[model samples]
Target: MPNAAEILVDTLIAWNVEVVFGLPGDGINGVMEALRKNQDKISFVQVRHEESAAFMACAYAKWTGRLGVCLATSGPGGTHLLTGLYDAKLDQAPVLAITGMQFHDLIETFTQQDVDLTRVFNDVSVYNVQVSDAAHMENVASLACRTALARKGVAHLSIASDIQEQPADAAKRSKRNRPAHTPQDMFAPHCLAEDAELDKAAAILNDARRVAILAGRGAIGAAAELQDTARLLKAPIVKALLGKAVLPDDHPYTTGGIGILGTLPSQQAMETCDAVLIVGSTFPYIEYYPQPGKARGVQIDCDAQRIGLRFPVEAGLVGDAAETLRALNKRLEQKRDGEFLGTAQNSMQKWREMMHQSEDSSAHPLKPQRVARAFGERLAENTILAADSGQNTELAARHVDLGVGQAFGVSGALASMSCGLSYAIAAGIAFPGRPVAAIVGDGGLAMQLGEFSTAVRYGIPLKLLVIKNNMLNQIAWEQMMFLGNPQFGCELQPIDFAKAAEAMGGKGFSIERADDVERVLDQAFAASGPVIIEALVDAYEPMMPPKMPRDYAKNFRKALPQTPNRDLIEENVARQPAKTMMEAGE
Candidate 1:
């Protein structure tokens, strides 16, 4: 008979989970032993921090539409998984988090690692439970996995130490009173809106002369359908940050991203269009969207709750993005007038030219945009790009051009730091032979630099582009623009990230001058094993939005005299479109 720990591992294998990311501790000795015994069935990836394990699991689920599993011990180890688990919860990724508890008998007796994990995980998990009996181990594990996949969120199961070591009870398992065995394979149902609903949506869309389409993460696998619909409607597709890879940036119909990290053309299209079709996007910036009654709206989302959550829609179609778009396309009339899309495309071209000028700057201190551009140009066709949350995200959103087979993601919704490296590591583990890269700001990378060793230990060939500015550039700009205050408490001491990577048994490269950006990135990308390219960037480079708010300009002007390096900040601001476009109205 198999022990409860073995039963849990076997259940995971039945679900076709290929890898489990976690750290070992005394409380999980039985589970660790079971994993060691079944090494050939599944792979165990040991990470430095429990947080990284969770982040890796979330990223794994995001890239591959499969259940990502992560494990941790009792107390602090289990608690440490909260941040990353929340990332999965907010991003709607399917992940199973297995945690160990203290002995079954000593759970509430002030044991060394006896924390109430169920209560702690309640908010983050779609299904949270603790296993008390060995006979119920498989049942609980199966339920957790099913619920996670069904809900597209986190599922947690905490096993007691004593129960983990106990043998499965054959008598209890064979009892007819037990529930029916859950199937190993699960598939998403094909959901589509009713014919009348589709007709209503199609009528609204076909009546409008100037229409705009907004795509989000739910539209990921529907690229072909999305493009076909855009062509039929003569609509310009504006992507959310998470949906940046839905359509390539250089595509003729795409206006790129929206919101703070958006292109000028995307913002202009949203404001001017008479009608909007929002596909699987919950873009929160209400100010950037077409005013409430300005445009007749239609929205599509897999989850019914998210439909019309951001913008008021005349037709709220509840179904899969691709299916709904395909059905709607059949009903829509092909627009012969191409003026709206052509005008948007022309604005996108101008935006691209301005961006190229920034990327080709010959300044003494390297521009971060240039680094991102070089990194994007060097990526392989199948490379997966993970971007950290900061100014680097802005740079990547604008400059990184994803190719046909490429993938890109950020800690969307949660916007957590320290997730970039873990995401890259997970991508490498999931795809193996394919290339993976991370674009991280200095502050974000400093949060989880220890994970570099995890990549080195696993021999994952990861290319890291560290944009070194020695400051929390995003927060500083927000203080100046949003609060009418000078930057404060945002400065960071400089560190040689290249040297740090070399010390951790990985290859390292540095780029100080603007001319060295391309050569260093090429060398780092071509290097065997893991490599880090730390590029020193100018700190005063502003992350400007496409259309600057009036108050933001007033605030920035008020803080200029008090701000450090005002000349450099002003110089960069002059080159941005915000100055000329501000008076055009928000």
Candidate 2:
């Protein structure tokens, strides 16, 4: 008879989980032993930190659209997984987290490393439970896995140390090694919109002269439908940052990203369009949405609750984005007007010109955009980009164009830093042979620098591009834009990231001049095993939004410090003199 740990391992294998990311400790020794014994069926990725394990699992789920698993020991080990677990939860990725606990007899005894783990995990997990005993192991493991996959959220299970080694009950043995079911077979069916919902959405869409489509990650699976809908309505498609590559950036009707880290054309489309189609994205930034009462809105989302959460929805079509778009496409009449699309295209062309100029800058301290563009140009057709939050998000959103088959991943709703390296590790592990790159800011890299060792130890060929700007550039910009406050505690001591990589047994390269950007990037991309490339980016460059809110300027002037950093301010003004000057009304 198999022990509870063996039953848990068997159950995971039955669910088709091939890899588990985790750290080993006494609390989870039984499960670790089971994992060792079952090496032929599953691979366990050992990470230095429990947090990295969770982050890696989250990234694996994001990239593969499957249930990712992570394990941790009691107390601090379990607590450490919460940040990454929260990232998975907020981003709505499917992940199953398993942690160990003190023996059942130690309940409320205040034993070392013993805490109320179930209560601690309740907030982050969609489903949380403690395995009662050996008899319950199979059911708990199976249910947790299924629930995570079904709900598209985190599911957590904690097992007492002694319980993990107890033999399973004879009656429950049959369920222990059950064969896996396909995700589609095990989860709920993809919901389709009702005809009435489709008709109402079509009517609203058909009445508008200028229609704009805001596509999010939910719209990724419906690329063909999205393109057809854009054509039918003669609309300009604006993508949310998370949905940047839903359709190729070069699509004729596409205007690129919207919101703060978005393109000007996309912002213009949202501001000017008479009607908007919100598909599969609950983008929370209200300032970027069309002015209230100016445009009628129609939203398509699988979850009905998110239909009108961001903006007021005149018609909400609750269903899968692709199916809804396909149905809505048939009911709508093709609009003959091309003025809106033409304006968007012109604006898009201007934006592209600006981006090209930024990329081609011959400045001594390399423009970060140049690195992003050069890397985008050199990527394999199917390369996957894992972008960090902050300045790196802006750079990747504007500069990295996924050619035909490239994919992009980031910590979407949470916008967490330090995820890029772990995400790249997961991507490299999940999809071997495929090219994977992690685009990160220096700040983000500093937070998770230890993972560089993991990349080298595993020999995972992850391309790590760190933009060394020597400041928390995004926060520094926000200090001015949001609070009108001068930057404080945002500067950092420079580190030779290239040397750091070399210290960890990985190849490293440094780029200080514009002339060496392409050559160094090419060499980094071509090299096998883990590679880190640190680019000395222009510290003075401003991470400007397409448009600033009206209140931003008034607040900026109100809170402007008497002793501001003149050099920083001058550099920013020099880059976008018109916008900066106008914002100050100077």
Candidate 3:
């Protein structure tokens, strides 16, 4: 008979798990051995850190809509999985995390790596349990996978080191009766809104002269339906960051992303529209939305509880986004008035023109926006782009124009750093021959630089664009804007990222001059294996909001006098359009 660890691996295979990302440790030796024996059945991806394992799992789930599995040892290893597990939880991705605990007899005796993992994972997991016997392995593993898929969140299982080595059929000899086996089959029911609720939402949408649609990650697979709905309502579609690929940035009806990392057309649409159709997005920026009583609202979401959590809605359609939108489309009448959409599109055109000026600049130290735009222009048809948090996210949100068949994602709710590389790794592994790239800032990449070796080890061809600004640019700007404080403790010593990548057995390219940007990027992307392109971006390039707030302007002015690169900041700020295209008498 197989051991308990073999039983666990078999159960995972039954659920169709193709790969597991993790690192080996003494606590998980049995599981590691079993994985080695079953190498042909289920692949093991060894990451440098346990955190990256969890992150890779989360990204795999997000992109493939399959259950992502990760494993680690007890104590610090289990604790390291928290950030990525929380990212999975907050972003509603299905992930299964397995960790090995101390020996069964050493429990509560404070042995090495003896931390109680189930209790540690309590808040982050939808289902959390510890296996006390070998016979319970299959049942526990099945339940974890089921719960993760059913709830679209994290599920964790902790197995004692000794229990993992026992015989799989140990329960047959014991007096304890075995529980019924859980099936591996999983399916999502097609949920739709009631006819009455659909009618109410349709009426509100049809009655309004100017309608605006805010699409989030929930609207990802419903692009055709969303486009049809937008065309019928003659509405401008504004995307949240996570939903950046729902509609291409160049789509005529789309005004691009909303909020700080968004476009002026989106802000204008939200401010002026008479009705709002919110789909699959719980964007937290309330101030960027229409005033409470100004516009009638209709929201579609899979979770009923999140319906009115962000904004008051006249109708809440609790169902799948595509199904609800398709049902609601039946009730909506085609709007002939093209004024709202026309004006928004015109503003978008002007905004793109203004953005082009920045992206086409000839500054000595390259502008971040220019790098992002060049990268966007070079993306392959099916490339998966992962962006790290901070100024890199802002740059990508503003400059990257995703093409059809491409996908984009960031750490939406958690906003964690060091996720970009892991996300790209997951994408590379999930789709073997597909292109994968990560846009990351110098500060963010420094946190998980070891993962570059992991990419080399696995032979996953990941292209990473590191914006080498040598500073925590976002936090520095926030200090000035929010506290009127001068830049302090934000500067970073420069490191040659290209050289570092070359040392890790991967191709490396560097871009220091404005003229070298396109050539170096082309060379990097054309390379056979993993590549890293380190672009020396201007540190003083300001990451301003689409519409600068009065208080923010005041604070910026107050902090300017003492800022280190005040002259450069002022010059860059002056280059931006003083008013939005709509506000500039367009």
Candidate 4:
């Protein structure tokens, strides 16, 4: 009979888990041994930190739409997994975290590294359990994976160090010798929209003169359906960042992302639309929704609880995003008049103009938008861009066009920084032939710079684009915009990131001039192994929404020329052309 650890690996293999991300430790020796024995069946990725293991696992799940697995030893190692696991939990990504614990007998005896991992992991995981008995290892392992995939959240399994090496057949079997549960057989199909729900939603869309559609990650596989629905309704499509891939940014009806990282056109569409259809998105920002009672709303999500949590929906369709959209498309009457779409197109044109103006800047300090644009232009059509959370997200949302077959992933609900590098690493592993780039700010890069070693070690060929602004630019801008407070504790002494990459045995390039952006990026992209590019960008750039609140406007004006950099605003304005071109096919 197989050992408990071997049984655990077998169960994971049966569930189709391809790779496990983790760091080895003494407490996990038995599990590690099992992994070593099964190396040919499943792959293990060793990362620098346990937190990074979780982060990579989360990213792997996000990129592949499958359950990502991670492992760690007891106590501190397990504690380190919490942040990344929380990232998966809040983002609704499925991940399974396996941790080793001290021997079960030594639990209350003050054993070294004897932390109560079960209690510690309770909050971050949807399902958590400790496997103390060898016979139940398969059951616990299988259930944890199933629960995570079913609930679309994090699951935790804690195995005692000693029990991990015990024989699985030692415990009593059931009377009939029933087979173990297979996830594929036990998994429930996603809910589909009801006929009445679809009809009601279709009627609302057909009656409304102006419509807006919001798509999220749930709409990933339904791109053509989403586009057709948008065309039928003559609606403007606004994506939550996670749904950035649902439709190309250059799509005539798209207004880009909504909220802080949103475009002006998208915000206007939400405010002015007569009706809204929210599909596959549980975007938490309620303020970004159309004002209450201003527009009728219909929400479609597989999870019923999220149907109308943000907006008051006239009809809530509980079903798969694609399936519901397809059903609605069949019933809804296509709008003939294009007035609403035209207005949206005009606004989108202006938004694109502003973005282009920023993209084409020749300002002395350099424009971050230009860097994003250059990379977007140069990357392979199927490249994956993993962005960091911060002002860089704003830059990416506005400037990076995913229309050229690019895919995007970020620390969405958690809105955490430092995930960019790990995400890029996972994407590289997931799609080895495609280019992967992590667009991170210096502040975020500093937090997980050690992960650079992981990239180099694995030869993942991940590109690191560091916007070296030498400050916590997002928080600094927020301090000024929100509270009218001067920036505090946000400044950083500039570091030569390129040199640091060189020291770490990776290629590095540093660009301070606006003109050098494309050339340096091209060189970085062509590098055979891991590459890091340090781009010096204007520190004073504002990470503002399309529209600012009245009080915020007053505060922002008062903090005029926020950056000490002279002629920054004037330089930016002087660089704008007389008329903005409608480059996005408007």
On lDDT, the candidate that comes out on top is 1
TM-score of each: 0.97, 0.95, 0.97, 0.94
* Model 3 lDDT per residue over 97-130, tens place: 9999999899889889889999999999999989
Residues 275-374, candidate 2: write the lDDT tens digits. Answer: 9999999887898899989999999998887889989988899888888888999999899999999999998998888778778888766778888889
Query: Relative to the true structure, how large is the alpha-carbon lDDT of every model?
Result: 0.90, 0.86, 0.89, 0.84
- In model 4, where do residues sit more than 4 Å from their true spots? 171-186, 557-586
Q: What is the Å distance of residue 268 in model 4 from its true position?
A: 0.5
lDDT of 1 by residue, 36-63 (tens): 9989989999999999999999999999
For model 1, the stretches where C-alpha displacement exceeds 4 angstroms are 170-180, 577-586
- Per-structure clash totals for the candidates: 0, 0, 0, 0
RMSD (Cα, Å) for all candidates, in order, is 1.7, 2.8, 2.0, 3.3
Sorted on lDDT, best first, the list reads 1, 3, 2, 4
Error of 4 at 78 (Å): 0.7
TM-score between model 1 and native: 0.97
Q: Look at candidate 4 and tell me the lDDT of residue 135.
A: 65
Which lDDT tens digits does candidate 4 get at residues 1-586?
8888998998888889889999999889998999999899898999989988998999999999899999999999999998899999998899999999999899968889979999999999999998867667767788888899989899999988988889867756566535465444345666877788788888888999999999998888889888899989989899999999888889887889998788778888899998999988988899889999999999988889887889999999998777788888999898998988899899888778777877888877887888888877776778898999898888777788886478999999998888899999999878776888778999988888888988888888777889998989999768767877666689988888898898888999999999898778878888888899999998866666677666666665566555454365334423433112111112
